[model samples]
Target chain A: MLSAYNITKNYQTNGRVVPVLKEVSVNISEGEFVSIVGRSGSGKTTLLNVLSTLVRPDSGELKYRDDNLALFPEKRLNRLRQSDFAVIFQFHHLLPYLSVLENTLLPFMSSLRPVSKQRVQQARAGLERVGLADKADRLPGNLSGGEQQRVAIARALVKSSRVLFADEPTGSLDKETGKQIMGLLMELHQEGLTVVMVTHEPGYASLAERTIAIEDGTIVH
Target chain B: MNLFTIPLRNIRRRPSKTLLLLLVFSLGVMSIVALYQVSLVVGYSLEKKLTTFGANIVISPATEKLSVSYGGFHLGDMVFDVQELPEGKTSQAIRSIKLQDRIAAVAPKLVSMTKIGDTSIALVGVHWPEERGIKSYWAAANGRFPEKPDEILVGSQAASKLGMQVGDVVSIYGKNFSVSGILFKTGSDDDSVILVELGVLQTLLNRPDATSFIEVAALCAGCPIEDIVDQISMKLPNTEVKALQNVINQRMASVHFVQKLALSVSLVILVTAAAMIGLSMLSAVNERKKDIGILRSLGYGKSQVFMIFCLEAGFIGALAGFIGYVGGFGASFKALEYLALSEGAVPVFAVAHLLLASAVFALITIVAAVYPAWKGASVDPTTALVAL
Candidate 1:
């Protein structure tokens, strides 16, 4: 369960204020697979980032299960991101120096405790689920674009988080690979994982249980 | 996995950057260490050479002299008396002073005028063993120091004036003594004098158990010369004990100047090394902005990112410090050799000094890297999504 009310975000460039997101509001129920669809410069990704706590809006009240995340301190926000929320960026921002398994386990590295054997095994299983088990020890630079996106998915799944935010997960992949990635997300959503994805593709938006089409920083439907 | 390992992995990932930092820092540290080591040796060697000027304190029997001029007619002073010090008693009293350990040598001398082949010359009697400690500058142009009491060492000017050669017999107050050595010209009173045994000269002068004056070479480098003079004066109340402050000040000034110059140059080098490390780390932070953003998105705190960068700088500092120390040790000997002072100087490779230097350099590098690390940590997590 996540919600945002009257969220407004602006960008400043060369002393000029440009509104990226006007007063916008949306809500999603538990276990719902929702897609925020918009063209380029439509503030769809900005809305997703604000809801995910990656970016703070200039004016908004964002709530996640009764807690106003906008008012949370940075430390608590970081803890929430580590424990209950994970993001899969379109670019699959895996550290080039780390192996696939290491990148999958990167979320757990923030903890002071050493990653447990069970946690590592879970990470390995997540990689296997993404069809990257054999490439566990290979660096991200050594993987194909499609495989790298899968590693990003495995990283998100390894957190065992309550919410998964996918920002154009197939944005950089070929058409067939993008279809495969969408199929994986569909299966993940079928397993009762809450997925909030941002995509401009109508077909992918149609696959979601709900679609919130945003135009000029406001959700139209 | 942890802060330490993460930075090390990143460092290994960027070899050229790490090496650039290491080379700059190492060269700076090497210059500093080499200057330190060379200054140490130079200070020691200069002190030793200046000590050869010798006899920083003098003790003589206190006596009075009065002028004999009257009615515009000027006359020389009255007391031409050779007021002798009780030989055994005066030396024992000097040795019994409170600061006895500061005394390096106590050479007693008895001076007398004597004729050699109708030429009048000053003949001095000295205790040979004690005189050798105070006179390290002495060198023989001819034979050697007198091994027997009946032998004499003739100064170069005195030998030339008296027409004397080594192994030639010279008579002093009707006693024949063989010249065992011709002294090198020292440009002092020593160049125009003949030296003989103290007891033999006292007996020849018919003032047995007597000494004209005593020269005490105190180890005055770190000791209080005035205090030694006061203590000696207390022990021998009948004698005048004086410290040669001008000589001590001149020598110590030279030593201090070398030490200060070395310290100033070392400070400059240290600052330059810190700046180099800082600028390079700042550049590194700029290049790794994406990594910083990614880490922050993965829930890594600002403090954690700051620590990782600082640890990377500390690692570079530790390695560079070690390499520089070893390089400096070898360079010091080469420098000493170039200065023609490596013969008797043995520079020590002390482990404590190495550890101290490394720790200091590491701290400097860490401080230098703090701002850059902070900048990296301050990167916004939202930057991670910009590529999408």
Candidate 2:
């Protein structure tokens, strides 16, 4: 479980201080599928980045299992990300030079812990779960947009991270492919995977067990 | 997959950039290797040629008498048990010198007083073959060299003073000698002497196998002339062996100057190569910003990212070094041939030197990549993903 208290993040743009997150607060319980909905400039992605420990809040107290994540050093944060967290980007962000299987195995390769045969098998199983088992040896460049996004999903879940943070996971896919991706997420959530997703689509946002709305960098409800 | 695959895959993905970096690095290494090898070969040949210029060491019997005279005046002084060099000792003493391979030539001379038509002149007996080796630049102005034991050669001054010509028979100590050649004017002690074979002059002077002094020409460019002199002195304890410091110093200075110049040039080339690799790596970092961010998000630490870039550069450097060494060695041989400087076979290739070159290049490359790799590792994952 993770919790935030009065998180405030600021961005400096050409000598001007712009507030992206203003004294925002939220709590994510274990095994809960939560979706954050907001307009284009509503600080939804900024909130996700802060919660994921990818960006530090200007002023906030973020806790994971009662441990102060905000006070942890970058090295500690990296370890936490490696062993306990996974992030899915809207653009997939897969390394173009690597094949699909290689992309899925990247987390294990980068982890401080030595990769085991069981971990490799788990990554293959993750790829199969995302319906990309047949495309494991193909490069990301050779895949369709939906297939690339599935590879990204497989990559995120390969290490069996406790929490998944997805930022518009199906933003670039066609409606039908987007529905398929959402269906996959729904099935994973039913299997007790904790997912925190940010999206602008009302229908996808409504699919989560809980939905939080934000307006002007503050939680509205 | 292992962590090493990422860098290897990245290198394979960008062929043109990697090849460009490899070419620049190899050219720098090639220039260094070729210049060093060429300088070594040419320096050796030049030193060998310089040995023939003149004698740098001299050996003579130690004199026991001292002159008690004013300037140009030989006031009478007592000679206490005058000692002369033993016969047949000059060659033996010279042979005993350490580093004898470095001794280019040894010319032994026996000087005796003789008369030619009522005029007293210095008759110098020399080992002709060794004298020719020492004075490689000597030439005859007229006629030809003396090939027979009864034939003799006269300096220009001696020929003019004695009114001698080729085929003229001259009497020396009741012996008839035909003038076979006249040497060119050298403007030295040689110009005033009548030259004859050492054996013939020793027999005529009634001092068989006697040598008054010896002149040794040694290649002391990389060796110590004092050591050779000391060895000669040790061999002939009653002889004074002296080194001509000025000649040896001049030769050594020239050889050292060439070597230093080549080394400095090679260093500059190496620095420029490092800078080229650094700039290229910087460009690569900029191009792969998103990839770095993704790797960080996936759990790669800063040091891991830095190491990946360094490994990529090191790989490029190793490949370049191998190619450069082989190419440079061949180039050096071609350079030597083109300069027409060396006459012998090329020097043997050293495996240790090749490995050292490769290691040096790899180290330089890794050092050059440090700043760029640090920059790559410092990329903020949040901002990088947002920008992408």
Candidate 3:
């Protein structure tokens, strides 16, 4: 289980406190698809960022299984992020210099283990899953928007990450393409991977196993 | 290809600015190379003069002091005692005795005062025949050596003053002598002197076996002049051999000073090149702000970004240096075309200068990139994601 109890975040901007999340509490189970829905500037992305260990919340209890994420050291959190949680963003965010296949294998760069054939096989399988195996040779600029988003999804799944915290993964896509990506997330959830996505679209958020609606830094559900 | 592409893309994104910066740095490197070539030419020429000047000693006599009074005779004083050519010896007599062996060649001379048309004439007698053994003064310009016992070859400047040339006759001490040759203008006293047979000069002036001074050539430049002077002084205590040795030493010192001056100029030019590299890199970093932000957000850490920028500067430095080296050597070859030089002519440009400029360019460029690279690397990914 993933849980956050009494989470708070504040930014010192222009010498004033900008609170994005305050005293929010939530929990997510394994193999569950939890989508966060909120208005713009309602702390939806902040909530996802806190869950993915990219930012630490002030005065919070964040627990994964029995390990409290708030208590884990930064290196330990990074290890967990790289191995267990794959973070994705609205933009494909691929490194422009590298090819699609190389971008998909970036997570394991820090690890001492050589990029084995099996790892490449897994990356190719993920690309095949997104139907972009043939486009793996191209740079991100050469790929279409829909094709690039599929590459991003494939990159997130290439490693067996248990929890994928994707912040508005389809926000830059059209309705039909966003639905198809949402369908891909549902398909991953059905295959026993946990997913938590932040979005503004109600129809997409409603398709999740459970939806957490937030507003003004507080959860309304 | 992956290693080279990112920075290449960054350079391409701002073509005009990058090209301008590259050219600025290249010009800085080129100036240093040009200065190096100049130093090589002037320094080598001066060094060769010092090395070759020692095999001969140009002498000026007292009394008439014609060579000494006007010839820029810088040697302060000469130690002389009435010395002889030794008994039963001919030309070999100069190097036969242990003391005289140090004397490789002798150009004996006499000078006396005489009046000619209300003006005084300094009658200088140069032993044209025996002078060859010592001065090897064959680098003459116009005519033949002093021959026919009374003929004279005057210095180039003195001949010009008298409106005389080869075969023209000039009155010396009320005696007319044909100017057989006008010596080359070596910026030395020989340009003003009249050379004649020593015996004839001594006879004409009625001073048989009288020499106002003597000129001797040594075996080599580093000859033991001090020891030789000490040995000869025991035999001729009134001679000032040490004084002449001191004069030669001072000339050598002047050449050394010029070399050091050239080196100082080169170092200043090198510093300017370094500054050029720094400015180019600084400009390049300013242009790549957005691209650096994107690369960082895509998961390249701080150190990786720094290495990438430095590597890019290194790339430009190597290319610029290579171009300067080719251009520098080519220019050096063209410069030496008309100058008179011996065979085995070594060009003055040092390979070390080219390499040093290249290394300095890279080092300074990296230093220049430091501030901007840090700025680019430290930019927050969240803020950068929103930036155009």
User: Which has the higher DockQ value, candidate number 1 or candidate number 3?
Assistant: 1
| TM-score of the second chain for every model | 0.66, 0.81, 0.48
Compared with the true structure, all predictions reach lDDT values of: 0.86, 0.86, 0.67
Ranked by DockQ from best down, the candidates are 2, 1, 3
Specify the poorest-scoring 10-residue window by lDDT in model 2 chain A: A107-116
Error (Å) of candidate 1 at residue B367 is: 1.7
Of 1 and 3, the candidate ahead on lDDT is 1
What tens-digit string does per-residue lDDT give for candidate 2 at A1-221?
A: 99999999999989999999999999999999999999999999999988988888999899999799989999999888887888888888899998898899997776335568888788889999988889889999999888988888888787778888999988988999999989988887888888999999999999999998999999998
Tens-digit lDDT track for model 2 on B1-388?
6777788888889899788888888998999889888888777777777777778888888777766888988788865664556556677768766678878788888998888878889999987888888777777888888888888889899899988889899988898999998999877788888999988998888788778888888887556787788888888888888898988888877777878899999999999999998998899889898888788877788998988888888878888888888888889999889988775736458999889888888888999999999998888887677655
- Candidate 2 scores a C-alpha RMSD against the true structure in Å of 4.5
Question: lDDT per residue, candidate 1, B1-388, as tens digits?
Answer: 5557667778888899788889888988888888888887787677766766788888998888888989899898877554779989998988888778657678999988877667899989998888877888888899999999999998999989988899998777889899999999988799999999999999888899889899987765545678888888888888888888887788778977997999999899989989888898898888888878777777788888888789888888988898899898889889888888744755789899888878878888999999999988887776634532
DockQ agreement of candidate 2 with the native complex:
0.44
Off by over 4 Å in 2: A108-122, A187-192, B56-125, B150-179, B187-189, B192-245, B252-272, B345-347
Residue-level lDDT tens digits of model 1 in A46-141: 999898888999998999999999899998888888878888888888888878998899888764468889888999999999999999999899
The lowest-lDDT stretch of 10 consecutive residues in candidate 1 chain B is B379-388
Q: What does each candidate score in C-alpha RMSD?
A: 6.4, 4.5, 10.4
**Pairs of colliding residues, candidate 3:** B79-B239, B79-B240, B80-B239, B155-B191, B156-B191
Write down the worst ten-residue block by lDDT for model 3 chain A: A106-115
